[model samples]
Target: MRRALGVVALGVLVTGCVGPRPAAPVATAIVAPPAWRTALGPGSPVRAEWWNAFGDPVLTRLVAEALANNPDLGIAAGRVDEARAAERLARAQLSPTVSVGVPTTDSRALNAFGTASTNLTATPSITASYDPDLFGRLRNASAAARAQLLASEGARDVVRLAIASSVASGYITLRALDARLAVARDTLAARGDALRIARRRAETGYTSNLELHQAEGEYRATEQLIPQAQLAITRQEDALSLLLGATPRAIGRGAALTALVLPPIPDGLPADLLRRRPDLFQAEQTLVAADRSLDSARAALLPNIALTGSAGVILTTALANPVGIFSLGGSVLSPLFDGGRLRANVDLTVARRDQAAFSYRRSALTAFREVDDSLAGVQRSGEQAVAIRGQRDAYAAALRNASNRYRAGYSSYLDQLDTQRGLLTAELALVQANADRLTSYVALYQAMGGGWTEADVAAVRR
Candidate 1:
């Protein structure tokens, strides 16, 4: 009969220990992402690694190195590990906890007739305990943790985008500053030549001292601008080096800013952003996590059913008296009058879930706006650059004509100075416009989600 009871108990335990998996939840829709601008040229979807459009091998190598070697990326990887660990911990709760042991005991006893007796005994047995999870408590907790793991993965991807974009932006700015420095030095040289010509002409009584002094002053002013521009370039270079996780070195990537070609903006379907951008994906994961938490909180209100059994020998080994015993049992707990605490917890979780839903909506809208803004930036910047191109050509021709006339004694040195300055100014503006155009394309690429891949997502999940 005892053996039959044991078998029935084992069967009952096995049948009772099962968990339910819940379906994943999706959040409400926000504004759709803006379609990419393709008016610049006919194009397919642009590749997300848009920095490669710069077509510089050095820039590619530098970006790859920074992405690989960055310490902050390592920190993000650690967070992935932490989330995965939490997921494992949550899953572990679904399994029963089992333990086994044998115990021995001895005691001396005196009879009424002054006789003493003692015996030592050991009983080996197995014990187990489990929370059946019939109300989905454990399952909901595990689901919550799994959602957090995915959320952390998305967060890591976000961090990766941030690092890559920062490095690219810094490099682009550094190159722009380098171009500005070159223009400043060339302007200074032209002004110095003008000063020399004026001084020589004045020495021969061909020009006035006033003209000579004016030329010298213009030359000195241009020379001063050179150092200021060079200082800016140095600071930017140092900053970019730091972004690449390095001490400042002689980081001279001499690709002219004008040489960088802006790839045509892509025209992706607006609905595709639901899977493309990491921030949006992260927001979705956050909402899922909050939903799981609500389930967990609600489950807490239900009566908890637990089975705990132990079969370990308890030995009392006092010198005068020793004893040993074995026992097995279980406990069950139900929420009986918790002063509305369980309801309050459930309400709080629902509120937090609503908060996550709102956050997701905000992120989706922001992503759409970014795509729109970058699209406009690309088209408008290019148009503005086209207008400047004409101005630049006209200024170049005027500078040349003024130089020739000054040498031929037909135009004043001031005319030459002014025209040359005008030409340099136009050239600088054109370089800046070109850089801005490229940066706008980069922004669009990032808005479309860069660097994240299926493999990257898988790796983070692992």
Candidate 2:
């Protein structure tokens, strides 16, 4: 026993000197910019339920339904559960395991005097074993699993934010299509009246057949727009239904395209994006998991210590009394030789950690670009909508003037047709511009993480 103890002490001392070295700390590749390229004015902080900021109850309700039923969210949740289980498994390795076992035997055997004898024997034992984690291997593994759990949770949030944004943007587009259809129908009605007036003038010799034909052709052109708009609306509704995780069907509307309130610009700094965006948070956590895993892999190069003990009683029918038995022992396994498997694992983990670092950098850069792009979209689209509205008003006035001049025979019917076409074009363009402006707000909200915070992930971990 003294020799065994001396050997163990010597081995431990020798292995400790050659244990795995700590890896160099990885630094983030990209730094956050001081400010956004497109400067935004002061605005409210992002809301947890950012979709509700649009002040449309229907849009809010749809987003709620989608969040509750989206299959992608279900998958993400399953991954979180899996990560939690993995964390538990890793943690279990740090603790001792106890088990009970029983063995029984019945047999007939010849005794020392050559007489045949029947006997039964039974041994029941309680055994325990543990890995002392002398090298911090199990702890690093548990930490890696914990980080992965947080990453999975962040991924779930990313899916949720995306779903909300998609629903809001789709709803806005549907309303825009509705507004365009309304415009087409209204223009078609006006064209019908003009065609009637032209027929009357042609029959009474007040206008020629050329004017009558032009009115009929313009009326047909406006009429075709109605069906085209209807087709587009149907497709948009179907697309929204898919987002809602329902069968293709009509979507409820609470506000017109022009009436839907524009959500406030979500306020966030570039640095804040690291914590505000779930994707970025997920990426960072993934990097953490990889780093911890690398630590575990490096620890694998060191010795593993295990302690085991068992206590039991053996009973035999031939014996006069039961025999007591007990054992306690420990082992140290140091990797003296392997075809480079342990070293290769360390290298593999290093590569994975580096990949995670670069991926996090890419996600951060993407988030910055998205925020700037959405800001530009919101500002530029708003400007375009304003200009288009002014143009629509001018076209409306010109159409009225053109119609009156044609009625008074001061201009040809073609002049009125030209003004009507311009007015219709401007009205359609205005609807699109409004939708673009609203959807840009949606994009900005999504880019700003839709009010997600690191605390949300912390709460889940707790």
TM-score of each: 0.81, 0.85
The lDDT leader among the candidates is: 2
Off by over 4 Å in 2: 1-47, 111-115, 266-270, 452-462
Candidate 1 wrongly placed segments (more than 4 Å): 1-49, 101-106, 110-118, 121-123, 252-254, 268-270, 311-330, 451-462
In order, candidate lDDTs are: 0.72, 0.79
Clashing pairs in 2: none
What's the lDDT for candidate 1? 0.72
Question: Candidate 2 on 73-100: residue-level lDDT in tens?
Answer: 7898899899999999988988899999
Tens digit of per-residue lDDT, candidate 1, span 1-462 = 111111111222234643332221121222112221111112222234556767775566666666666778778889979999999999999999988777566778998999987755566667888999988988998998998888887787777667767777777787887878888888888888888888999999997899999898888877887778877876776676666666554464736677766564323333343346777777888899999989989999888888877655433433334344455666668888989999999999999999999999888878777777677787888999999999999998998999999999897877987887788889889878888877786776677676323443343335
Q: What's the lDDT of the predicted structure labeled candidate 2?
A: 0.79
